[model samples]
Target: MIGDAWLWVAVEWSPPSYGLPFTDQEFDTPTTVALVVAAVVKAAFLWLILRAPAPGPMDRRTKALRRLLYLTVAYDLVLWYPLALLLDTVVAAFDLALWTSLNVLFLLVIRWRSRALRATAGTMFALELAGMADALLDELDLPELGSNDAVGFVLALGGAAAIVLTVVGQRRDGRWSRGTLVAGWAFVGSFALMISVVALADMLFSGGLVEGIALDALGLVPAVWLAATARELPTDIGPADRPPARRRELRVAMAAVALLPIVALVHPEQSAHHSFTGASPPCYDQPHFGDLKPSERDAAFLCQARIRYSGVPPIFPDTLPDQAVLAYGRALCRAKDREEEREILTRAGSERPDSGMDPWDLVYVCPEVVGATRPELLRSAEEQKAANDAYIAEANARCRDPWPRTKGVAQATANYFLFVDGDPGYLVQDPGDKAAEQAAGLAMDRVYDDDTLIGVGGSAVLVGHVEDVSDLCLTVKAFRAAPPRRVAGWDYVNEVPIVSRSGQLTVPEMDGGDVGAGAPMPNLAIRGKGRYRLRVYVRADDSGEQHLVVVFPGASRKRLQLKP
Candidate 1:
């Protein structure tokens, strides 16, 4: 009952911006049915967690195991609640409070003779509630006692211990139902199997994609199996859901459980989202990645995968699962830059109402976790969308009417290089190699995501003006059959390879470093959409006269030649 109810909770929670289909769980629109279900489930969870084992032959052994589970759960619950409250995870605090209240009530109501059993049972109830709460935290990204391997191992061991207690009790009572046995063993099997695969994903770091799927399958199958078994379980069941001792089918079930690991091994190495786990401890004072179940980690990354800065600077080697918010802020909004950046950083420091923290944190942790402290360093969801959308619209307009606009030539000292794609167009072609993508030829595109070969896989040039870059106007015009001869007047200097996938090239493709407070250039492109041997030329100081012109088509062309 608790499992089924908790599953509903997972389905209902929806975080802001990354909300699920449903916007709220029980809180926002707490219907009578929801309230009723919540109360009953909470009660059921409490009862199951706290109730001590029925008096039986193995009571002593089972009692010892439950004690271990209880003590650990109690210790962690005490530590987790304050953080949960600060983070607005009221649900977590409520759970701890209810568990405490129940423990107090049980101690008072039960006779002193049975006080030991009641306390034991109360601890058990807390564990079950913790499991239910975990489902919510995973779905909602709430801060709490995170689900990790140690917890999983303990849970599986608990399940195994439950099976033993059930079997001993059922045989002693002589009415072990087959359904109970099957369900109990299956729980132990699936629980252990799921936990084992998660451990493997952790140990085999890069296999996230394949291993992640297997882990999900392992989690879901067990949930369903337990639900069905619980619904059909007979009267004698239940403290541990033990099955009959003499059933021959028991061997088959255990054997099946033994074979389950193979399924995980055969799947792809990791979860689909990351295809690999991000390094643990991605930063200081951060939770370890292991705290989240593999699926939860994948989901969390998916929620935060948007790259804020146009290009992530290479300095911060951090990867996904790190503070998704502050990813590029350190690179994009450093205070050491021109006055614009420095002023913003300084202003943010003065404005931050917090006691005292790194003012630069405003940039580093964009979409700050605690709240939207991003004054300007980071783009709020609204700003990010607006900026990207605006960029796309302008880019589209240019790609359509691509004639070189009559803008003043970038002064003699242009950016480091005006990299154009077509390297693969004139070189080898391999999709996996970031360098060889242009071989696929240019395909016009409207959408780009560092994927789409048409947008990626190209070449670059050390575009220069005389000593720096001889830009009368650096341009390329496509020639289907062949281009015209090199225009006269300009002296041909050297030949360099070029690749234009999407048949588009942009000028002053600044390396960013050399790009001073120059003209705020559009991040769009020029229309040289294919491979070419761009013949470099320089017009002698014709006294800066002759209306400097860099013409194409009047230039020779040939079908892209790939190096053998």
Candidate 2:
């Protein structure tokens, strides 16, 4: 329950911008190393502290150390763990709080009861066993393990019973040996059950037993600690004569010990965002236009193309302009037919604008010739009508479906299909609609913790200037090269070219141009028959040394080449 609550809080409060830059493998190394080191240090400290001779009557240093350890352990289990749980839950809204809280609570109970520490440890071991069972079930994608509510109720009742038994047994005989023994055996039995479940799951599912083993190891820690400390009990002692100073020292030591493992678990290279400039390989300093060797020029062109088209700085060693130009040139060279050459040349010509070229003329000539071959690429007026009909059908079906089961499913399914199918144009045919949908989706997705469906909408505002619509076409084409996989969920859209320009390519304010009241032209285009193409129609007054800016959400921009 706490885990669920924490997950809710995390999902609601966390920003969408924060994400780990490295892959799981890349991030695991430092975290694993840190955890290992911390664990070793903690174990060493615990051993040394336990091995130290009992203070005869009293020793101040021992008392101080014990107090520190107690405080540290208390802080970690009671304060730090809870806080971390809260933070994590708030950030992702995943149900991890229950696991974190239970772990800490078990540790605390063990610390409070020296004689029954073994029992407490054993109970924790049992919980770990249950945790392993749960993990295995999840890995296997098994049916819900009972219901969450049922599981929570059972756990609560079990905890209450254990507490009652401990309190009653302790008060009656000043020792809970029988109860402890029973609890220990029960816990061990639970562990055995979990092992069986894991083994079965491994056979059925093929893998995931390793996770169960890791969980089991985690569960055994308290039991090991209890066993190591069990031999030193003074039998006739009562609560009145218990050493407060010694208790404090033990707590402090345990805390210090715990800190070691946590430190080791965190990855060192976990960055929220990656800077592409740092990752890309070296490239030429200048625009090597027709002077360099073909290969070198190709490399430089790729770098420029990436820079100009991506709007983001280079993530790889190539430039955007060079890449676009080389690609266009290659297409031209390989053309076997007159029609193919025209199409390829049209695509190549659309990339860079001549210094004195009229923006409107360029937009008119390029998109018409280049985009003509791929009429199907453009979402037709009729197709838009069809999409509207499909969306309505889906929405109506959603209402008819059972509650919760299909409430969010239709929208999610549509978004997923859109992403998987690599067609942002389906979501919106016009630039303004595209921008609006993208913004709205982003906002809504954050609120619902539905990153999977909401991430497909493309940004509307261009980040950099383009010489002509051809540049814009190329930029958009590159952006559409690879759509995100719906199942995997969208993290980043790959190969989106950002277009940067030497001069400004500003759009007129709403009142200043024909774009304000009238419907905007759809930016959708398709590649066909070895050539790039799109259809372009423009209002008369909308003319200039136009710059088409393509911006990816988190990437840099680059320029596309207009001609070979």
Candidate 3:
């Protein structure tokens, strides 16, 4: 019941991301609305549970079923009230970490003897797995181990163990009754269908509220299917004296039903994957890619050209792979594609969405992670400290002096200033930023509520309301102190914390281009990059917009860091 949307409406709340990455992109209108709709859906779930037919009698199996059903429903409805009441107004994020902890608790029933409960629990576990399906699939597809490989491997094993135990427990309980078989099939089968349907839906759509609702609506199918079929589920094993003759037929039918979703989901996803990465027609999709080429039999395929490539007419090189790893110790930008590594020409898919790892992680001093291929790659981690120092030192040699510096924050204008990466190369060549397209023409509250306007990934558009597609100049500033409650002759737009660890601010993501006001490094000289506060103040004049930001020092607290 309590999420950013509800709280924003209730208390005018906003996410504390400021200009930092990760925490940005949250509490958005679509997210909030989806949460609201989910709360309503969960409430509807409770009602539907009540509406579900009452149990036939009280057996160990029936008791176990009700135990889980009632207890989970209770916890789902009740667990958040205290958190919202006592803690700050941020909803606990929904991600792998939270899901792992919650599902791990279900292992308590591993010792229980009810096959029906195990089946249901196994089915419930599917909920989290479905959320993580693409991530798991992507990790499974990795040519070599990526950062999250361990977590993914462990979770896969843990979930498999829990499910296996359920099947083992069922086997130990007498021979399989037809009723037991039906119930087991129903529980597991429905979830299998749900996983495929939901995951495929994700691959197909990004229309925020509509996509979310459509996914949730698909969930009702499996849930209601399980409930409707619940009466036939008998936890007790063993055959009746006059068992039906056509047992094999029933098994095949359930197997077919369970496999239906997998086929439905994977076919489209694999097709889209081929379409996007290989520059094939994005089968079963509306137009998003640009370079559409005619394929066999009048079919069309689309190719991608990166926004940040340096070229005349031809934008991207074919060798530019989809992902890269900046091995700082080796001082190399290694392509993630195994084919690229072996000099075998092939294409790979983009980084999976909702995966915690970014396409570029901590990438201020590195070259284009995707495009570059270094002969000297995969060096030792021990060189990391020395390599970073040498890299920065070399950058210092290759840079110009007195990168853009501005002071005295607190302004009264309409320009929304931003914080971005300050790579020595970027400092020397201040290419313009492509601030988030979604943030354009929105209110200040909407910007802070939705984006980490104060932080830098690749310089994104600072959220500002505008009339037409007119061009504007942007500026950057850093602070080491907190802004005073009331500042002199300036209207406060927003303020949030920014932390610097390597004694440098990140440059916004950009390739070579002449931005009106190139994103130059701000000369905020200090001992090293440490945690600091950034206060954003704006004013609207055609005067280069240099003083759009101010920096304050020292932050009291750091907000939660969300991950996949």
Candidate 4:
């Protein structure tokens, strides 16, 4: 029942923006349910602590563990009440600090209980502390001392060794009481169970529901068992003070319990998020961007793009004249000055000697002047109507609808799609290595060459870790041939590049691969015999008084052969 309830809590949690969807508190049903569950867990913890047998004369470890229990209950109470209810930066910091302290205290108790368990707990605890330091560095914008993955690897190896030692030692020595054994095992087992459930659940769901519920259950069950079972052997007169018989069953149970920590330590990498260090590669100067999850990349992209295009001094010093012209044209269109918009745009088109600006881009800049002077721009009134409707449909789909836009860009473009998060500030392309180039070209060609090929692949650039929002823009581009029309379409429409607005691309979490999780793009379509070229551009817009920024690498005109 507890486990299932935990799953519900996970589903209903108001996790941070990076974790999952549905972060708004307006949908308070799940939070309310979680609160109820938390209350139950807290009550159980308190009951166990209060009802447990008091420590006898010289059970120092027992006394220490009892004190830890009281502290834990206090911490949980704080988490349950006003602290949990009020979410703020300070609250988050307090929560993190309390959580770390609790874990550390628990480890100290384990170390105090038995010399055999000490080494195991000590090693893991030390690693945990280091991981915490790394996390702290990331949070404070300090250089990372080491990678979390490395720390996890070491912890896993050491934990496996510890487990073997503990089980072997238990099998040989039987001095521990059944109650003590239960408490000891429960100490490790509960934490392991929570960790395992959370890791497995992450695989199945993006939301934090599964993990949250399990955490509550984990926090209570073992503590209850410990309190109920805690009974020190009486140390009184003569023979009465002798220890209880060591049971074979209890030893076996201890052995089984020893296995639990191994499970917890198995995949330490996943725990990296809980750790202090940012998981981003050491290449990027700033840890801020590295901390952001792929789900929240859209917002990061928009924030960065706006800065780059603002023509702010020292950031983007040289604004392209063409981009400036396009920005002006867009402003004129917005102000309902269609005549001036057309004249300026038309004159700009005629006079600007091979301006990098494309006709399709100009249309977006001045959509109101669609029919006045550019009759050739649309095939007919019906085509114009379709285009206008498509424009509206695209806007509505991007603004209001969820994934898989109204007319899937992937489908409309015959799988060729391009979604860019404008641009941050810099540019660097793949300096073609023969082996890598051949591989990328072959991958692209294979899809275009074979009729049996339904899947497509393209080149990806994972430029290590980005520090600030300004460090990078999420760019995803795919090109498709314009649908054949009787009237000449806008020149750039032949290779229409669609840009993804903020909050559009929701790729899976990056695994710290070489490509570093580039923005996702649609598949490249191969329908006709003509060879294709890929290009990228930077453009600016004036959308609702915000300076628009679009900086992207142009695709190489190096044509990929259609034939195999």
> Taking the candidates one at a time, how many backbone clashes does each contain?
42, 73, 31, 17
Superposed Cα deviation of residue 95, candidate 2 (Å): 8.7
Candidate 4 residues 230-258, lDDT tens each? 33322220221213463344334443343
**CA lDDT, candidate 1, residue 415:** 17
RMSD of candidates 1 onward, in order = 18.8, 26.7, 23.4, 22.8
lDDT of 1 by residue, 290-400 (tens): 344433433333223222233432222224333332333333334453554544424333222222223333323322431344343344456655664564444323221
Summarize candidate 3's per-residue lDDT along 465-498 as a digit string, tens digits.
2212232233454444443434443333555454
TM-score, candidate 1, is 0.30
Query: Candidate 4: which stretches are off by over 4 Å?
Result: 1-46, 52-55, 58-65, 77-81, 85-120, 143-177, 202-215, 225-564
Measured by TM-score, the strongest candidate is: 4
lDDT of 2 by residue, 1-564 (tens): 344233322322222123223323232444344444444544543453344323233234324433443444344334455556453324222223333333333343332445465345335334433433444334332332424767744544444445344334333434324533444454445555554665577455434222332343344333332332232222233443336667565445444333333333232432212212323553445432323432233444344333433343332222223334444545544456666755654545443322222222122223343345633323444664566556544532332111123221011111101112222211212233324545435433432233122222233222221222211111121123322222222122222221112111112222322121111222232221121111111111132211112212223333222221
Residue 69 in model 4: lDDT: 49
**How close is every model to the real structure, measured as TM-score?**
0.30, 0.23, 0.24, 0.31
Runs with alpha carbons beyond 4 Å of true place in candidate 1: 1-89, 110-362, 365-376, 380-463, 466-564
| Candidate 3, superposed: residue stretches over 4 Å from native | 1-243, 268-564
Error of model 2, residue 510, in angstroms: 26
